[model samples]
Target chain A: MVPLSWYLALSAVLFTLGAVGVFLKRNIISMLLCLELMLNAANLAFIAFSSFFGQVEGQLFVFLVMTVAAAEAGVGLAIVIAVFRNRETLDVDESNLLKL
Target chain B: MTFEQILFILFAGIVVGGAASVLLQRNPLYSAFSLITTFVGLACLYVTLKAQFLGVVQIVVYAGAIMMLFVFVIMLLNIRDEDTAVDPNRFLVYLTIPLGAILLGALLYVVTKVNLAQPTGDEGGTVERIGTNLLTKYLLPFEATSVLILMAVVGALHLAKREKE
Candidate 1:
C-alpha cells in the first residue's frame, strides 16, 4: 500500500497551489486553468477515499464531476470570449468594467 | 520503495511541475498545454488508486475534451497579438509562494492526524458495477447531467455567436 495520507497530502498541495495561482495570475484564462487544477485535486481526494474504503460511489461522483467540469469548461470559455468581445481584453485587471 | 510508491512519485512530479508551469507560462495557450500535463498525471494517479473507470474519464473528458475546448477558445480569441500584460501585484505573487508552502505543511499535519479504517476488500471498482450504480442508484443525477450538458451546449452557442447589431 502506498499509504492513503500521501494522496490526501498531495491533494492539499495541489489545491493550495491552485488557490495561490488564482490570486497570482491576472489573466482570466489562467485563473480558469487554476480552477481546473483545484477541481482535479478534489477529484483526487475522492478517488483516494473510494479506493481506501473499497467503495463505488466515489467513482460515480467522479463521473458527475467530470460531467460538470466539461459543462463548466465549455460555458466558462464562452463567457470569457463574450467578455473579450465586449471589452477587448483577457486580463482580469483590465476587464473591470463592473468596478465602481 | 514499492513499484506503486515509485509510480506515485513520478505522477506527483508531473502534476506539480505541470501546475507550476500553468501559472508561470506567459501565454494562456501554454497554460492550456500545461493543464493537459496535469490531467495526464491526475489520470495516472487515479489508475494507481484503482479507480480505473474514473482514470479513463479523467483522460477522455478532461485531457481530451476540456483541453480541446480551451485551445479552441484561445485560438478563437486571437490572444497572441496583444502584448503580454504583466501581473499587477508582483510582491503579492512572490508572497503567495511561501504562504502556499505553509498551507501545504498544515495540510500534511492534518493528513497525518487522521486514521481511516483499512480496506475490507469486499467490493472493488469494476466498470460493470459502476454502470449499474449509475443506472440504478445514481440514475437521477446521471440523467440530470446529460440535461446539464445539453443546456451548456446551447448556452455556449448562444453566448459565443456574434450578435447581429
Candidate 2:
C-alpha cells in the first residue's frame, strides 16, 4: 500500500496551492474555482484517513461535503452572473462598490 | 517502486499539475477545464484508496454536474480573458507566499506525527453499506442536506432572475 502520509502531504500541497490561487487570481470565478480546489483537497484527506482506518464516517462526510459544494456552486455562480450583469467585468478588483 | 506507489505518483502529478494550470490560466473557462482534470485525478486516487463509491460520485457529481454548471455560466456571461487589473493591495500577494508556506509546513509536521493503525480490511465504502448508514446512523444530516439543496435552488433562482422592466 502507498503510505498514507504521502496522501496527506499531497493534500497539504493542494490546499496551499488553492490558498495562493485565491489570493493571486483577480477574477471572482477563478477565486471560486480555487475554493473548489481547497474543498477537494480536504476531501482527499478525509478519504485517506477513512481508508486507513476503515471507517465509513469519513466517506459519509465526504458525501455531505460534495452536497455542500454543489449547493455552493449553484448559489455562487448565480451571484457571479448577477455581478457580471451589473458590472460587465469579471475582475474582483473592479467590483469594489462595497470597498471604501 | 510498487505498482500502487507508481499509480499514486501518476494521479498525484495530474492533480497538482491541473491545480497549477487553474492558477496560471488567464481565462476562467480554461480554469474550469483544469479543475475538472484535478477532480478526475482525485477520483482515481479515491478508487485506489478503496472508496470506489466515492470515486464514482466524485466524477459524476463534481467533474460532470458541477463543471457543466460552471461552463454554462461562463458561456452565458460571455466572459473574456481577464485583463490585468491594477491591484489596490499588492502587499496581500507577497503576504500569501509566506502564509501558504507556513501552512504547508505546519500541516506536514502534523501529518508525520500521526501513527495510525493498519487498514482494518473492512470495506466501509460500498454503496449498500453507505446507503444503509445514511438511512440509519446519518438520517438527520441526510434529511437536512435535502432541505439545504432546496434552499440553494430557490436562492439561485431568486438571485439570477432578471427584474421586470
- What TM-score does chain B get in every candidate? 0.85, 0.93
TM-score of chain A of each: 0.96, 0.97
* Residue B116 local lDDT, model 2: 71
What are the models' TM-scores? 0.92, 0.96
Scored against the true structure, residue A88 in model 1 reaches a CA lDDT of: 83
- Candidate 2: where is the Cα deviation over 4 Å? B82-89
> fnat, candidate 2?
0.75
The docking category that best describes candidate 2 is: medium
Angstrom error at residue B85, model 2? 6.5
Q: What C-alpha lDDT, on a 0 to 100 scale, does residue B91 get in candidate 1?
A: 82
Residue runs of model 1 more than 4 Å from their true location after superposition = B80-85, B88-95, B117-123
TM-score winner: 2
Residue B34, model 2, lDDT: 97
* Candidate 1 C-alpha lDDT tens digits along B50-146: 7877888888889998999888888887674343455565687788878988888888899888667647654556789899999998899999999
Cα lDDT, all candidates: 0.86, 0.91
Q: How well does candidate 1 score on lDDT at residue B87?
A: 55
